[model samples]
Target: MAGGARASSSSARREVAFRRATEADAYELARRMFLSGERVDMQALATELGISRATLHRWVQTREALLDRVLGDLADEYFTRARRAATGAPDDVIVAVAEGVARATIASGAISGFVRREPELALRLMLRDDASVRRVLVGRLRGVLQDVLPDEAEGLEGFAAATVQLGLLLVWPTLVAGDEPSGERVAEICRALLAGARAGELSGGR
Candidate 1:
């Protein structure tokens, strides 16, 4: 029974790897089709994968679902790797977070570009309360602020974190200017907001 269990585990790993390989191929073809400014035809992708369209349909189900899988997975990978790449110094966490987010925003051009190509999808995803981007922002960013504002204990840090994430969308051009976005500027404003909030210095508040 022990030997059988080990064999089953090994076989499971192999099957996982093979399934990932197949998905990678399909993802690659979809990306290329998306990049070419042509509609992603799952049928062509299935042909490339040596599977029928119905089989591809069984695998990914729909074009939107496949695109969602590809883009969402890419975001996760980028966030994971970039977060580790951060220097993680006490004072510099804000800067690291900003750069990390900037990288993500730029990397998300793939999805954003796709959104531009299809207005209806753009309206669905980018406009009118996108739960996807919100979830993505809140997930990775919780850590960045948690590390950055240790002094502002009692969840002030969490507020700052939320502000930073949402602020990027609200005032993006000013917040992130050119190749070298002003992480310092963002940090300064965030720090000030936190400080002011604590001291009851804000003008339009309860």
Candidate 2:
């Protein structure tokens, strides 16, 4: 009986060791799964890591939290690239960056596929306040706009929020019904909005 108890204890130790998961490890796996157009199944993730669902939960909170991290990482990547690729005056730079983001997102097969596969989840996670991805996106755009138009930074949040909402509306049709990805349409719409914002700023907040 003592020997059996020892063996069980040893097995428990091994399981505990095997189930230890770091936040970075969980995020890397989740992000890769997202980029590959695979469903981010928490059970499968835990299984792949040889860990229990409870362990994954401890490492990354909940499934929604893990997804929020993965989506935020993906958006950051695209937004960074867009900012780097942009060049021009304040208005032009904002427009260029916005256009870059629109094109990159619209062209991503994985994002499109994920949206098509899980429309309801996408809408909730993206448009709702429960997820941080949309807020992170809007915050980043607001930061860029503020940088470009420092004098108008006081009221830029509302404009940035509206821009995010409008962009999502434009892309919803494509995501829901497999409509063609129209980068030009997004660019024009954003161009008009940004230009109008600039013009408003110049015209005493009209």
Q: Give the C-alpha miss distance for residue 3 in model 2, angstroms.
A: 49
lDDT of 1 at 11: 51
Worst 10 residues of 1 by lDDT: 171-180
Cα lDDT computed for each candidate against the true fold: 0.53, 0.71
**What TM-score goes with each of the models?**
0.55, 0.80
The digit string of per-residue lDDT tens for model 1 on 73-174 reads 555565677577777564455446545655565544444456555646543442233434445654666566556555654444344444444445533343
Instruction: Give model 1's TM-score versus the native structure.
Output: 0.55
Off by over 4 Å in 2: 1-20, 198-206
Judged by whole-model lDDT over C-alpha atoms, candidate 1 comes out at 0.53
Q: Which segments of model 1 are wrong by more than 4 Å?
A: 1-24, 31-39, 88-91, 107-112, 126-133, 146-206
Count of residue pairs whose backbone atoms collide, per candidate: 0, 0
Candidate 2, position 151, lDDT: 87
Expressed as tens digits, the lDDT of each residue in 1-206 for candidate 2 is 33453455344434445656566666776766676667888998777667788988999888877877777777788889999988888777777777787788888776787788888877777777545666777888888977888887665546666666677777755677778656677677777776666566322211
**In terms of lDDT, which candidate is strongest?**
2
Among all windows of ten consecutive residues in candidate 2, which has the lowest summed lDDT? 197-206
